[model samples]
Target: MRDSFHHRLDVLVLQLARMCDLTAVAMSRATDSLATGDARLAEGVVADDVIVNQTRTRIEQDAQTLLALQSPVARDLRVIVTVLRSAEHVERMGDLAHHVALAVLRRHPDPVLPAPLRSRFQLMGSIAVRMAGTTGKVVRERDPVLVRTLDAADAEMNELHRSLFQVIGHRWAFGIPAAVDASLLSRYYERFADHAVAVAARTAFIETGTPALI
Candidate 1:
């Protein structure tokens, strides 16, 4: 029974990694759609979100089963609890990606981001993708060093988010709609990075039993 429990735990980690991968892909494609005015790619991101949701459900059920059947204690229990929480964070990241795609779909051929803001949004997208990829590594390796990097990455995202406001504050030719989209898009990317940091922090806590502050 103990061996079986460990096996399930291993499976749980693999499942979480899979979720991270899907979320990363979604973030990447959604950004591409926004940058290029590709409605189809944006639609694809929206459609694929169902897979992320299903994976989260599987991770949750597996963690719950481990808790109920194995009665994990100490680090084992922490691992299960952390997995449950991290799954939610991952799911929320997926939703943020979906929101980005929806913005693209809503705007269609006419790019949601203003021409001047395109490069900034692209940079934000790149950072978000990098963060999502690192999140997968953190979940699998649970390295304190990698976990710390996530906090820095999230800080970068916040800085970029602030820059978006600065851009909006200046003379804007794209009008109110563009400003609104830019604000929401910036927020989505920031939130996506935030969730990635949350997942990394939870993984660190599970490994070291020390809660990470960002």
Candidate 2:
């Protein structure tokens, strides 16, 4: 019974990790679609949002089951708690992707980012992808050190976000509609990165037994 129960818990963790990967892939694709002005890709990303949400719901249900059945303790309990929280963050990340896809579809029946801003958004997407990748690793390996590296990555994201604002405010002169769209897109991307950092912080806490906020 104990062995079977432990196996169930293991399955729960793996499922949660898979959900993160799916969410990351969706976000990466969404951002790429935006950068490249690929309407097809944007449509695909938007379609995948439902699957991501389902995966998140499944993870939450599984976590609740494990908690009720296994009665995990100490480190085990922490792992379950982290899984629950991480799943929520992952779902939100997926939602961010959907938001980007909708923005692309709305702004560009044939969407293309302004040339100057493309590279910056691309870099921000890269950071978000890296965060998702790192969080997956931390979950699988329980590596506190990798989580710390994710913290450093978050710093770079902040710098990029600041640079984006400076560039947009000074370099481009857009009409009101374009300006509003650009601003909202930038904010969404930055906030997505922030949530990724939060996931990494929680992973680090689970691994290191320290709740050091990043």
lDDT of 2 at 95: 91
RMSD of each: 1.5, 2.0
TM-score of 1: 0.96
Candidate 1 off by > 4 Å = none
Per-candidate TM-scores read 0.96, 0.91
Tens-digit per-residue lDDT, 1-214, candidate 1 = 5687888898898789779888999999999999999999999999999999999998999899889988889998998998998999999999999999999998877879877888888888889999998999989988889878888889989999998787788787789998999999999999999999888888889878886665
User: How far does residue 39 in candidate 1 sit from its true spot (Å)?
Assistant: 1.0
Candidate lDDT scores, in order, read 0.90, 0.79
List, residue by residue over 136-172, the lDDT tens digit for candidate 2.
Answer: 7776776767867877888887788677667667757
